[model samples]
Target: MSLPVPPGPQYADKQFYINRGYHQIPKLRLSMDRIVKETVGLRPFRPSGPRIEAEQLGSKTIVHNYGHGGSGWSLSWGTGNMARNLVMATPERKIALLGCGTVGIATARLLQESGCEVTIYTKDVPPNVTSNLATGTWSPASRVCDPAVAKPEFRGVWEDATRYSFRRFQFLLGLNDIACWTDEYSVRNEVPTASEHSAGGEVYEIPGLIPERVRLGKKEHPFAADFVTRRSNLMFNIPSYLHYHLQDFLAFGGKVKIHEIKKLEDIDALPEKVVVNCMGLGAKPIFNDDELIPVSGQLSCLIPQSDIQYKLSTEGANFIARKDGIYLGSNGIVGNWDTTPSKEQTEKVVGILQEVMKNMRG
Candidate 1:
């Protein structure tokens, strides 16, 4: 057997490469890389399950369902289910919904299903709205909190949220802009493979798993290690999706009123006695709710790069996505709340991307 040639030092931590006469030759790198994995856990709801109890808030008339953090979209369907139960006991014909984001839309739809005329009173509509600003990935696990700590009375709330959103999206699986269920591959640092005893199949040693892009692969394709790709979905086009949702709402005889509430007295002015709040990131001043705080996040959109359909992230402060454009940014950067990319940061990301592209280009 031929001995593996001893190679010279090059990039520290990188394996050395040697050629006919060249020593420490740089190895071929790939433009594609893995981005850091995010545990998309929803924000934990505070101790105030019902700041206004059911009986106190006019249970026979009012239903409060709001304060969902980032997972608002993901948990909307389920949260709506619980809220619908409130009206189930009552025979109310009209209901008022605060906020017109994903949560509001879903709750309004659920209310309409119960033969109730739903009015969405919000300062903004869809498309030109905050819901449209989301990346629209289909991970419905977060946005609320760890449901265990919720009041025992709210035990069924969390489960209802997960099940409702899951089944709802399943029903709208192939809808137009609502959800662009495409192939997304999430590559990451090497990790231990799952054991067959737990996996119920042959344990494949996957050094790199294609995490996001959901695409059917060509037959007989080879991989570096045991890799698994699933149906990764994202809200590729938020504007279009919001339009579709708005149309659905209007079609169902739901009305949207644009009005901003400055104080608790504003909510008191609503004609409908029953109110379901679906305001996202708006609980700060609307109800004088001090628990809601803004944990700011920023992203950058670059020129489109179709060749890079996949997303990449290192650990933190580094994320690269190829969508309508090559989107890249870091949430971990300090003193950088500005959404507009700084020239220095832009150049730095561009350089990192350029190196990745050079190494991976076939």
Candidate 2:
């Protein structure tokens, strides 16, 4: 008070850049201990959000909860709740749940909470199905709809889902080994080309969904790129998260059967009066949704680095290090269904990271 305080810009510079002791962020370096493994996953992306509606088929009432695209995990809790409210409208005490992916499991769990006996029918379960391939970021509106085709009325529904899903994710926090944690940094040298089906546009632009992002200056950022920024979001370790949910589902009297359905008639044959279809990508062929497409995605798994706690992405590529290992992801190929992990693509992404380091040193 004796002396006049420094101006705002000078104070910000002093606090953020000049004060090395207080402004301590990590210098980026990725260990080259050859990637332990690599894998690819296909995102069941629907441009018009997930199909959450009820349709009558023969004597059975069918409720749809599929085609969530990249937003499956983020939207699962809300959509499950939405579908369950529909299921509750009926008096059926027993329900048939199709598929065992994230959405399927979430639906079954929600139904269990509603006091319904659940039978999960599927060809595969977690860690083996397509759901395991997701990078598991908390982008709820991702690839959920196409703007041109999206109605003005959809904003209300989309906003509702985002709100509900966020509330559910908070309950999963503080599990062992970063099953749900935050990635705090993302440095971009260039802007990513937005696709028509890109999930980052209007849906996330809603009020009070995501927090504001910060643009980092030279002292605040450690990357080589001319531009740097930081934003925080959730990442669900799909393997562990599913394991936690599936185990509890069984404890709560849920039954799992390994059976594949080839046609709608098979579903009609179920004894349960109500069937909730959370088949995810499998619905593409069975339901013949022409608008749905396979989004080819690949992630390279490097050894876990405790020091690297943030995320990085440029162009169509994404790089992040989680508790398990480093994940290097390529851009989604909208119509591509190939799940083969490309050695060349992984190497290309690695080079991008290396270049970043080199530029930082220079």
Candidate 3:
């Protein structure tokens, strides 16, 4: 019922930031590093929060845990635990996990940790699933659910899942080259507000939706922008993180079978007693979930630059430097359903990222 207090603004000192020498990194451009790859991934988004309940069919229990939308990786660990507990309750020691993307793999491991034997049935494994192509920021609410239609109680579910996953990801911060890392963000003007800022959910009232934001003096910030807001954001380098999860799952006696189930009848054929549906977008056709939409997203990867440890967010796109490479992206199209990369969009993103990098160097 009370007004929210905003962070106090600090004046940007031109001389203070300029003298810091944070801008020492050489200019990075799209042309400088060859484009190693360009990838497109359709986020399995259900405007509603992920399907985390169960269905009973002829003595079989199928717990639906997919449809996380774009927040699959960000919310994986928490949802994994959610589905794991559901299966644990059924006294079913053998579990079948559908889909092997971030959500599926995470859920598979969680079931294993719960003393259940998990057999993953999927069309593709890590670094191959659509999850591998994500520009995976630990942004728990990025299209996780359409807050407009979400019930008031959904906020509680989101808060618990986000906070739980946040803690779980922290445990991976410095291990295995730590696929999870933070990067400095250079703002062109005022910091952009997240999309979920005004969805009328109680989660909006929670603090730390993003890491603490600090105003960078003109010289202190590494970028060329006159006004900059620096913040540390949790980023998951998809390729490396996927590998880590796969290896971890395999090390723990989990089994994976390369197969895709097209309909409900296919459930009867799996080796496990209970199933956790992490099929993501596949749930739409398989389970007839008309609410699920494939939000098409694309990212272009260039050569890696170890010196670059920052990200830049402009009006329509973002540029990030990851362990694998610098990523340039994207123009989102909802309901488009096309996964093919757009040459025009790709060129425009390159311009946006290259212009920012050039300005920073200047």
Candidate 4:
């Protein structure tokens, strides 16, 4: 039998508590390390243009959108929304989506709403593969290139995409079991409250608040900061969430074809002439997009700790509670594409957690 769902008493709580005493997540420690090592920035890449040559594809007929790097999830809804606006001018009644990841899913859904027949051609589907492996945090970490090297117009697109996605997530939160949106506390080290490090601060509040049991103490903080703690709402268990999206797609009459293509021509050959390619890092091989590099992220999971309902990060080490277990990650430091958790890495993560907890007690 499938395991029982974790209790959601605290998650349902509406009034998010901001731990003012000490921070738990290691923002200060991680920032200090990044500044010292000078490796804290995201990969240096940006959209060169609509990943497709308008002249080559016949402008005003086929639309091109993809190459989001890492912000694909955080910014996809907005980008798809913008892409749909462009479709208004296209005489074509249907659109073909190239990838089935979050971007492809959002694009297909949006196209359906526009009264268009959408078909997604992908080798993978929800829960089984692609994107569900993501830690699924809201932070726009990664997917940024050097401003000097990026095109001027692309920055505005990124900005609009991000804002648009934030609102869409808000709307999905109340949609029931379909989308699992919850406020999760992101604990961090206590920096001086007046410092810029406190932008937006921790202990964020989310909508659709469900009353949950409170776990608080006068000095209940993590090991990093002076009484560092937080009450934030972060999405957990992405597979279940993706399942809802897939179901919704089918219910809306959208069709998904499970097929692997060896060349971009295969995609171009589809019955639907208008194609929007959102192949993520896969673009490197499919479209010979060497610009689309995969920056790997590795996370170590401790045996489930229900009471560990908050997240803590310091010096690249991070711990966030999820439906599966407490997700411990060194964030960007654990090496990209080495997605597996090693014994040494696991031990190191435990050490980091000990330090964070110890610091919080002090």
**Top-TM-score structure, candidate number:** 3
**TM-scores of all predicted structures:** 0.66, 0.88, 0.89, 0.72
Could you tally the backbone clashes for each prediction? 22, 4, 4, 30
Candidate 1 wrong stretches, greater than 4 Å: 1-55, 58-62, 142-156, 190-231, 234-236, 303-313, 317-326, 329-355
Query: What is the lDDT for 350 in model 1?
Result: 48
* Residue 131 miss distance in model 2 (angstroms): 1.4
Q: What is the per-residue lDDT of model 3 for residues 1-362, given as tens digits with 9 covering 90 to 100?
A: 11222243245433332445443444665662477888888888777788898888776899989988777888898888888778888978988888899888888888887788888888788777888888767667777877788788878888888888888888888876545566556455544454412111123434776666576554455576655655677888788888888888999998889987978889877767698999888888888898988888888888987766766667566777888888877555778788888877788877777777677644
Runs in model 4 lying further than 4 Å from the true structure: 1-62, 177-233, 333-340, 358-362
| Higher-ranked by TM-score: 3 or 4 | 3
How far out, in Å, is residue 155 in model 1? 7.9
Model 2, residue pairs in steric clash: 45-69, 47-145, 49-144, 143-199
Model 4, range 1-362, lDDT digits (tens) per residue?
Answer: 11222333233333323554432232222211221111121221233522432213533245555665445566568878877776656677677777787777887788888898888888878654546655666644243443545677766666667667777887776555334444344334333331122221212222333233233333343343332224444453665667777788889988899877677667667887677766666555765666655554455555555455455444436665566655565444312554454556656766765665654432
Where does model 2 exceed 4 Å of error?
1-33, 177-179, 190-203
lDDT of 2 by residue, 1-362 (tens): 01232222322443344534233444455544557777877778777667898888888888899988778888898899999999999999799999999899989999999999999989898888887877778777777777677677767777788788888888888876434656455556554232321224434555455554555555555566654555666787777888889998999999999989999888888889899999888988778889788877788887776776766665445666666676776566788888788888887777777776666522
The CA lDDT at 74 in model 3 is: 83
Error of 3 at 48 (Å): 1.2
| Total backbone clashes of candidate 3, pairs 3 or more residues apart or in separate chains | 4
What is candidate 1's lDDT per residue for 1-362, written digit by digit as tens? 11122233222422222232221112222232422211111232333332222333533255666665445666677778777877666666788888887777888888898888989889877654556555455444332333454565554555556666766777775676455555443222333233211111111222222232222121111112123222344444555656777788899889988988777778778898777777665655765666554333344455554554544432222333334444554332222223443555544654654553454312
> Who is ahead in lDDT, 1 or 4?
4
Q: Order of all candidates by TM-score, from best down to worst? A: 3, 2, 4, 1
Q: Give the whole-model CA lDDT for all candidates, comma-separated.
A: 0.51, 0.75, 0.74, 0.54
